[model samples]
Target chain A: MLDVKAEAAEHSGAGAPGEEAPPLVVEGLGHAFGERQALRNVSFRLNRGDRTMLLGLNGAGKTTLFSLITRLYNHRSGSIRIFGFEIKDKPSEALARLGVVFQLATLDLELSVAQNLLYHAALHGLPRREAAVRLKREIERVGLTDRLREHARTLSGGQRRRVEIARALVHQPKLLLLDEPTVGLDVASRQFLLDHVRMLCNEGGIAALWATHLIDEVDSGARVIVLHHGQILAEGPVPEVIRRANASSMREAFDKLTGERSE
Target chain B: MRPIHYARCLRGIIWREALRFINQRGRFLAALVRPLVWLLIFATGFRFVLGVSIIPPYQTYIPYQVYIAPGLIGMILMFQGMQSSLSMVWDRETGSMRTLLVSPLPRWYLLTSKLIAAVIVSVLQAYVFLFIAYFWGVHPPRLGYLTVLPALILAGMMLSGLGLFLSSVIRQLENFAGVMNFVIFPMFFASSALYPLWTVKQANLKLYYICMANPFTHAVELIRFALYEKFNLEAFAVVGGSLVIFMTLAILGYDPGRGLIARRAGTE
Candidate 1:
């Protein structure tokens, strides 16, 4: 499965080979605001076709780390690389392979769904004809094919999020970074989103880093990185992390790890 | 990125701006009404009070309405520029600006595209105002209209660049009202838009110098001369120089590593 999608990505010119570097790499990433350190010594690597859950409580620097990775905020003390291209040095090459669904909904409410998606596709330099085809395919994937002409404001919250996911995929990015993508979502909507993204990673060979504070979202088969107070408390396969914390489930493991640090 | 990519991105940004402008019926009305009020009522009321000598652009004595038509056009461009700035701030607050920022293109190219989009909208608005003014007996030479296009574009670029610079520094949508009072109003009132420089010179030498120093004044002068099929070298130089300066500063202000975004990153 991985090889099939990897070959597709290579042919599509989405993945640039750089000594076969991983999809994403963060090394000694540190960021501070005046006197308050928001993120400290954050280091991780996400390989192709990997699904990693970045689990943390509120104020654990999840958003800050995402911001640096997205290049929304500059990282002064560390480095971030995408496909072996450093973010600061070769942002165009680095960001070309990245797709992001931010926590906040960024759609222009006045524009139709298709318009919003096409605008994003153009930003990624896709030709108009190709963008239109991808727009149809991606929106169909999210089950919004019938709502293409509807204004974004007319869509419900769940529908809006699905469109955002479709927009992120229109460029055929190799790595998808979703920051609390399921926040404020209903149970059904959340499950649909979680499943859709995981399926994309598994079948398309697109590396994904899903950040969330919700424990139920992390499956046992997934790798987990537990962050607490701007530091990583544990990182491994979900079951291994649970075993290391001496807890039976992810919830207990997370509580135990964060609880010990708070004391 | 290829040149084709840049061209497509520019087309997309401008198309988006045009679509937004078309959708906001109230915004279109407001842009026209503000300038029309000055032409129909304000200029009419002051027609006799503000007597005009035969200026270089004016071959003979003209009514205040005709004299101020270009000023009203300048007003449209300035207000549209400020409106673009307000929308930028709103986009930032709503997180749509992040969508643009995270694109694979260079930051400077993205910002320049945005500025060009804004200038295109402002110029369209200016032409609409000029068309209305034509029916109001504010006719310039037929060739004047064609000549004014370049001036309107240059002046629009300068004003929009100013707005773009202001948008980068203004942190919040709420703070934009302060900019209206502190920047827009002052710029409009202290320029040659409403009155001639000589009139202000007679009133106060210091005020005249202030007007001379004001970039808005030069923008108004540029538009005034272009409306008469002439060019003011000084005004052209000043407006062009201001466009370069403002555009450079606006680009720097949006730079992720060394700009205002870096300073505010911790808070976000």
Candidate 2:
């Protein structure tokens, strides 16, 4: 295999002029536990105002990569710069600038919708008055105003998932890292979430990395990174990657790249 | 995330515990029976075989029931602390604990908050046990004994710390029950809670040293001395040392990268 970690300079295309540094610049990332290697010298840079989609199969190390980015786990040999600060040297600062919604919903189902969001906002240290204003705006954006007074346990899975995403954005992070954001969502809710995420990337100028196994979630204009069996199989503009793929749908392209075939 | 914001998360965790217990009063009532059985039936029956004498803070003769109060209270704290933490394993099994752990806040603070809430419940249950002992006619100096508060707090902190450590280490909820056999009973039985170190010395010289070595014994002795309105510096030091050591272990147990909670859960 080519040395992906050593090619950082070649791949580090600075964002367009007037655009800020990439929200995340990861290079030579590697980790292992005892004898089992979890990640191997992975390198990728994600810039602000860029809407990048990450497609990977199960066991593709997507969650491990996200966990390391969040510093839920530390990297053994790598450098991760989030918002211009090394993650280890300044974890709170780096994490504060990024909003993350993991595959599992972090909403407290026992608490009222408002209570859950308020609690999370307080965790991020948003002042009460400030959080209230942001909470109102984000809740409405997710169409959860009517459900604020009810317990999250009562909301449907889609509604609960949306509320969780809104909770992550209450602090106005510069980057949004969503892991399988639409998992278990009905078709309508999935579309609703995708539309809002795209809007956030374009209108708010927020950089985002949406990790999913679903190919249809990718937007035509976005950059794409395809991971398979713990390695990056492809990375480039969506159209160009597919042009090389020579497949009709993005799924076919993903399958062709990963060498999976229909039964 | 801001570090001080952790206090709010702690309050939220305590609130969850309070809500669950209030909704299920039967659990507290049910737990009360075990200690009551030990105190009224077992202690009374064993009193005849065991000789009693004057220890410090005792004006004259003391009954076996009064002697074992501090030990029983220590037992309450340890078990309740383990009870709350063991339930965390249950929460993880059912997938609720994941919701709490994945929040932006640090994981250690979340476990600490849960421990504090468990301590409150344990201390409250202990107070109830004291009141029932009063009705059973095993009274000590009521006002002087209020020192039990600080003593209970110290013991509660230690037990909570112990429980937090276990939550991270145990592989499965069922395996945690085994922890009780190895840890809980030995610590309680070998402590000075049931008898003074002097009494243990008369019976078994080695046993006296073991009781002196048990930190729980010091917690019970601290409460015992305080009940008579006397303070033992050595006992106080032991309690303090145990709290610090246990809390340090708990902090290490919560390190996400190496924590046993995930390791045992088979999630990694």
Q: Estimate each model's TM-score.
A: 0.94, 0.82
lDDT of 2 at A186: 90
Candidate 1 global lDDT:
0.86
Q: Native contacts retained per candidate?
A: 0.62, 0.20
**Each model's lDDT:** 0.86, 0.74
Interface RMSD of structure candidate 1 (Å):
1.6
Query: Which one wins on TM-score?
Result: 1
TM-score of chain B of each: 0.95, 0.89
- What is the CAPRI rating of model 2's predicted complex? acceptable
Q: Which pairs, if any, clash in model 2?
A: B168-B261
For model 2, fnat equals 0.20
lDDT of 1 at A147: 100
Off by over 4 Å in 1: A1-19, A260-263, B92-94, B172-175
| Interface CA RMSD, all predictions | 1.6, 3.9
Please write out the lDDT profile of model 2 over residues A7-81, one tens digit for every residue.
332245443212144677888888665566666778887766678898887777788778778766567787887
